[model samples]
Target: MNEFKKTNIENPVVVIGGGASGMIAAWRAASLGVPTLLIEKNKKLGIKILISGGGKCNITHDGNIEDLLKSFQKNEALFLKPSVYKFNNRSILKLLEERGVETYTRDDGKIFPKSNDASDVIAALEWYLRNAGVEIRTDCSVQEIIFENNCVTGVKLNNEIIYSSNVILATGGVSYPQTGTTGDGFRFIEKTGHTIVPLRPALAPIKLSNKFPYGWGGVAIRDAELICLVNNRKTHSERGDFLFTHEGISGPTVLELSKYAAMELANNKVELILDTQPDKDATMLDSEIQQLIGLHPNKQIGNIAGLFLPNRLVNHFLNSINIDPEKECRKLIKEERKQLVKLIKEMFIGTIDTIDITKGEVSAGGISLKEVDPKTMQSRLVKGLYFCGEVLDIAGRIGGYNLQAAYSTGFTAGESAAINYKSQSTTP
Candidate 1:
């Protein structure tokens, strides 16, 4: 056995996984004078944190608790209210600042380290954990949770068992399995008699059945509105920048609605409706086209359309609608103009084929929140068991909401676990 694994303390708070929530939980517990041990399967800690936001690491979002709560889904917002209120963005930023990691918020409210280095954030957390006297064991994987009579006793490894009075499961969701979040936490929680919500990919790129044309892969539509339709009924819509990929669509707008698209795809035909000219309705756009035709009767129709869209997209639209690019604007018939206007106003992009969970920014499901106390992050089913971070059924949208949730839930779980352990130890 390794030196770290051989060293064990009695009644220590054992934290499983060493991601965002796990590190914070261990830090909080140890900071409160409780013996805490954090175990990670990976060789190093915070792999996900190091790779988040293209390695810049969006640490958290900037806003009040109410605005932050509004960024999540209704059920998630309701469940996350207490944790977020306790460890708001300001509190997290302050904590990081105290450890020499300064942060800045973008105009869109996404916060990143002022140094633009994810390593800085990870280093700060690791520093806190070490300075707080939290024992961290890397390359150690927990195989099972030892529970008896509705209480967690310890975690079982391949060759040994580490006993603890309290165990906090901070393993992240099954997204980006390369980072070691291979759904191991779900198995442990399920074995411990906790409900596991069906896991799915969220904030992932949408793969379309119809691939974009050869050169259209890198083309981006600024200020476009993406609408999701199920069974020909409009279900969800979002407006933002969207990028065309060889396989499908991606960007803020597509990623935000990808979860709903994935859920609706299993039973219904899901189609993406892209409004290229989101600023103008069909009638208004047709009128504008008419005025353009009046002013430049001899100009090519494609040229006029290019003013409203990218040249490549304009050519694609003209070809899809069976219009000749060489045709003069004056020669354009009312029906052809209507078709062009319709294409501009509402273009059916393609059907979503699948959402690859590996490409997902965060997994959408995990331990059911009903089995957890949101205020304390303690398991309602098992004593001495706590759940936090992506392991729980809470996932926030892009722009640092998920990281904030991890920190908040981890904070609550760590504090509560420590206090519970202290009280148990002091009791007669």
Candidate 2:
């Protein structure tokens, strides 16, 4: 550890929320010899990190800066470059591996611990902090930000007050309330005279209009294309694993497009079309269907369709085409075949509503990117105040992009906040 020769050691730099971003900011600052105090509302830090990647803890995507930067909100990426590339996925991955948390990359290039456990990731982050001399306070909620003459003096928590020279808010967004993302940080920012963009649910499941969605629950659609259309115009689409739940369809592909779907569904009826075989042309599919009918002329159309889709969808597909389940494959008329072909190509699933923000992987919209210094992450409105993690308007696509943003911005804020704190002290 660098001798925290800042001489402001008595005051310390307080970082709020000890999740992924908060952990990095606190650890980075403390490691550099700046007295750091990390406040966590949860009993322990990295609670969300422990459940990330379905317990495997996807650390980061194996993508270069160009690709990774493209995954984030456009305006926020401009501010993220300085931090993300400064201490990127490779750096974080390497640091954890050094601590014996060996990681392996998935087929999709997402990095996870070799043991595929999220607890290990949390263990490493906690260990890094303890070794770096960072003081951690848990079960403490930040009531408000204390400011004197437009400068951060400290944070108000419960009955007492904690003072600090530099303040970093890494408290995260309103998503995942159980994991401790209370969104109190947004309130705190607003109380301090900052602007917060309207929050929306992103990376969440899209509720379906199938009124009987529970009928298809537990069905899995693989390699299927999910297309969201608003007022007859295709808006967003994704292709991957889609799982049927009691409420709606979810998974990587659906979650990635849910934000766009929610936006469209907000104003009008949105159609979520599922194409079972997007690669096959209409004629090719028609020809294939003809062969199936010819080969199973005596077989029920419901039974024949089961060979292609989920077993639970057999009767549903038949009814959708206005055909009886017991109807023979050969009984399908020419016009009906054409209609079914159209349905096959553009199989529509009505999206009645959207999942709650509470179920989101991350909440989009936070401190507007315009109010922040892209180079150092210091808030322009509040000179010594810095923002990082999901608290900023930088939510990214699924995969490890969110975690990467946290590490990048946290590192940048920790470094810049330390330097700025030292510079201000010397002037007096």
Q: What tens digits encode model 2's per-residue C-alpha lDDT throughout 183-279?
A: 8888887766788988888887677656554678778888888888888888878888777777667778789887777766667888788877778
Summing lDDT over every window of 10 consecutive residues in candidate 1, give the lowest-scoring window. Answer: 1-10
Give all TM-scores, in the order shown. Answer: 0.95, 0.90
lDDT of 1 by residue, 1-428 (tens): 43324336565699999999999999999999999999999999999999999999999998889999999989889889998888889988998899889888899999999999999999999999999999999999999888898999888887777988799999899989999999988888666678888888899988887877778887888889999999899999888988887766788999988888888888888999988889898899999999999999999999999887778788878988999988999999999999998888778888888888778999998899998988899999999999899999987889999999999999999999999999999999
Q: Clashes in model 1: which pairs?
A: none
Model 2 has an lDDT value of 0.83
- Residue pairs clashing, model 2: 4-33
Sequence-dependent TM-score of model 1: 0.95
RMSD per candidate (Å) reads 2.4, 4.6
lDDT of 2 at 77: 75
Going through the candidates in the order shown, the clash numbers are: 0, 1
